[model samples]
Target chain A: MEKVTININGADYSAEVEPRLLLVHFIRENANLTGTHVGCDTTSCGACTILLDGKPVKSCTMFAVQANGKHLTTVEGLAQNGKLSPVQEGFHEKHGLQCGFCTPGMMLTSVAFLKKNPNPTEGEIRWAISGNLCRCTGYVNIVEAVKYAAEKMKESNQ
Target chain B: MIPAQFEYAAPVSIPDALALLRSNPDAKILSGGQSLIPLIKFRLAQPALLVDINNIGGLDYIRAQDGWLKIGALVREADLEDSALVRRSYPLLYDTTLSVADPLVRNRATLAGNLAHADPANDHPATMLAYRAEVVATGVNISRVIPIDDFFRGLFATSLAPDELLTEVRVPMPKPRSGGAYLKMERKVGDFATAGVAVQLNLDAAGKIEQIGIGLTNVGLQALRAKRSEDALRGALPDAKGIERAARLAQEDCDPASDLRGSVEYKRNLVRVLTMRAIEKAIERAKGM
Candidate 1:
């Protein structure tokens, strides 16, 4: 077992975890932040997406030990001061989800993408979240949610 | 799914990592874990030890020197996709990097790791081959540069020894008036190529083909260079007839197996089509079109 300390949601948490423990499991079990879902443990599904040092990555594809001393942001970190983040609010406003199984990953992926590309077209938005799959909702509302979040974030920054 | 039990070590220096690999012959070097972790979870690979080199500094850079672009082993694919230098100097590599998996996977996947993994269907192998790149490998007390042509031996196999780690990839800068393109056919985004082709070519002052390299992906046990196709195009006009003939030669060189992506014949057909298209685009780019 290796001891590792990781900053998740801006808080430090340390644990003695097996070398084989995945970052997704560490976030769900050790940190006790279960908002990040694991749809496909394989890298195919981005259901376990999280921001590692402000860049999004699939948490299931990384070992817990590898994330030692790194900053990570999960779905639980999207909101602050008891209010939803713009991405979360966008999803709520635009009805971005139906079954909601892929919502956390989708929102996180969009949040990071919008930071990089603030004004994405419909095609660009579709390409940005292509890694995160949604079996339901047909992605129409999800695309709108990303656009809404982009506009909201832009308005606030102005 | 969790991976099997293993001992992990994060080495901060190259020598320390090499020493660990020398001691643990069954150890696997973890660069990004975008590919290795999935294999471990599926029980396809069960290494007794994992040497994590992420903490090692100075191994995640994109530098240009001595007429070559050197990309450190730890440089992430997303970094290459976003690199203005790559886009300006090696547009083919830049475009190819964008087609590798999705944004999330690219965020963590490394170029050297992708080549070292030696997945026949992966994108970088062919792109490297077309660019005439070299892999820098370091071991216990030795460091060597292996040409990309000789690096891939077979499926999931490389010339790299168990104790050696691929440290960087060096690609020679394209000559003036040279152009290249990478074309891939996949079922959807983030999918491996059903058939992929990378072509780099240069035209002479007289507008005849001077130098050309063709690399084929996902159509054999390893990424292969179409030497016959390249030979046919060199010193000849890149007209539609000559290109069609070269494309047929490239198609004949491939040995594809039927799978979910397509049948052997269908993949061969794709090789023909993509090769022709790649050659045309490369020629146009060479002529500054």
Candidate 2:
């Protein structure tokens, strides 16, 4: 076992874990933050998405030891205190989900993507979330949710 | 799913990483962990130790130096996709970077890792084959530059020794009036190519082909350079007839297996069509039109 300290959503979690522990398992099982889902363990599905060191990555495809000293942000970190983040509010306002299994990953991907492109066309939004697969809603409302979040983010920054 | 038990070492220096590999020949060097981790999860690879090289510094770089573009082993695919310099100067490389798995995977997949994996379906091998790139392999107290032609030995195999780590990739600067492009046909986003073609060519002042390189991907045991196609085009202007013949040779050169992607005939014909289109696009870019 290797001792590792990882900062997730502004809190540091330390543990002694097996060297083969996947980062998604570390987040869900060890840290008790179950928002990050493990839909496809093969890295094909983006259900395990998270921000590692301010960049998005598939946590299921990385070893927990590989993230030993990195800063991570899971879906649970999207809101501040009790308020929903713009992306979260956009999802609620736009009815962007049905089963919600792919929601956390979708919101996290959108939050990070908006940081790079504040105003994205529908095509760009569709492309940005291409990794996150949603079996429900057929992705039409998800694109709307991203567009809604983009507007909200731009308005607040003004 | 959890990977099988293994020992992990985070090496902060190249020498330390090399030393770890030298001592544990059964160990695997984990750079980015985009491809290796998946294999580990599926139990396809069960190395006893994993040498995590992310802790090492001074490897993440993509810069032009001494008339060549040098890409360090640690540079992620996203870095190339976001680089304005790459977009402005090397459209061929930029195209390949965009076609890699997806935006999220590109954030962690390294160019060196992609090449070192040596999967025929991987994108960069054909791009490097077209560019005639060279890789720097560093072992304990020994480093050698190997041409891309001699890099891949077989499927999932490379010429790199167990103690060696691919540290850098160097692509020669393209000559003036030159352009290149890569075209791939995949089932969907992030899927491996059914058949892909990478073409890089330079034109003389008379608009005659001065030099050319063609690489075929996923239609062979390894990325194969279309030497017959290239030889037929040198010093000749690219008319429709010449381009058609070159494309036909590329179709004949490849040996693709019949699989779910396509039958051998379908793949060969796809190669011919993509080759013609890529050459035309490359020629258009070469004229700067």
Task: List fnat per candidate, in order.
Answer: 0.93, 0.78
Task: State interface RMSD in Å for all models.
Answer: 0.7, 0.8
Stretches of candidate 2 off by over 4 Å are: none
Q: Candidate 1: where is the Cα deviation over 4 Å?
A: none
| lDDT (10s digit) by residue, model 2, range B1-289 | 7788999999999999999998887999999788899999989999999999988999999999988899999999999999998898888899899999988999999999999999999999998999899999998888999999999998989999999999999988889999999999999888899999999889999999999888889999899999999999999989999999999999999999999999999999999999999899999999997
Instruction: State residue B191's C-alpha deviation in candidate 2, in Å.
Output: 0.9
> Model 2: per-residue lDDT, tens digit, A83-156?
99999999999999999999998999999999999989999999999888899999999999999999999999
Candidate 2 collision pairs: none
Work out how many backbone clashes candidate 1 has.
0
Best by DockQ: 1
Candidate lDDT values, in order? 0.92, 0.93
lDDT of 1 by residue, B1-289 (tens): 9778998999999999988998877899999888899999998999999999999999999999998999999999999988999988787798788989998999999999999999999999998888889999998888999999889999999999998989989988888788899999999888999999999888888889988989999999999999899999999977999999999999999989999999999999999999999999988888788
Per-residue CA lDDT of model 1 for A1-158, tens digit only, reads 89999999889999999999999999999999988998988898888999999898999999999999999999999999999999999999999999888999999999889989999999999988999999999999999999899999999999
Docking level for model 2: high
lDDT of 1 at B285: 84
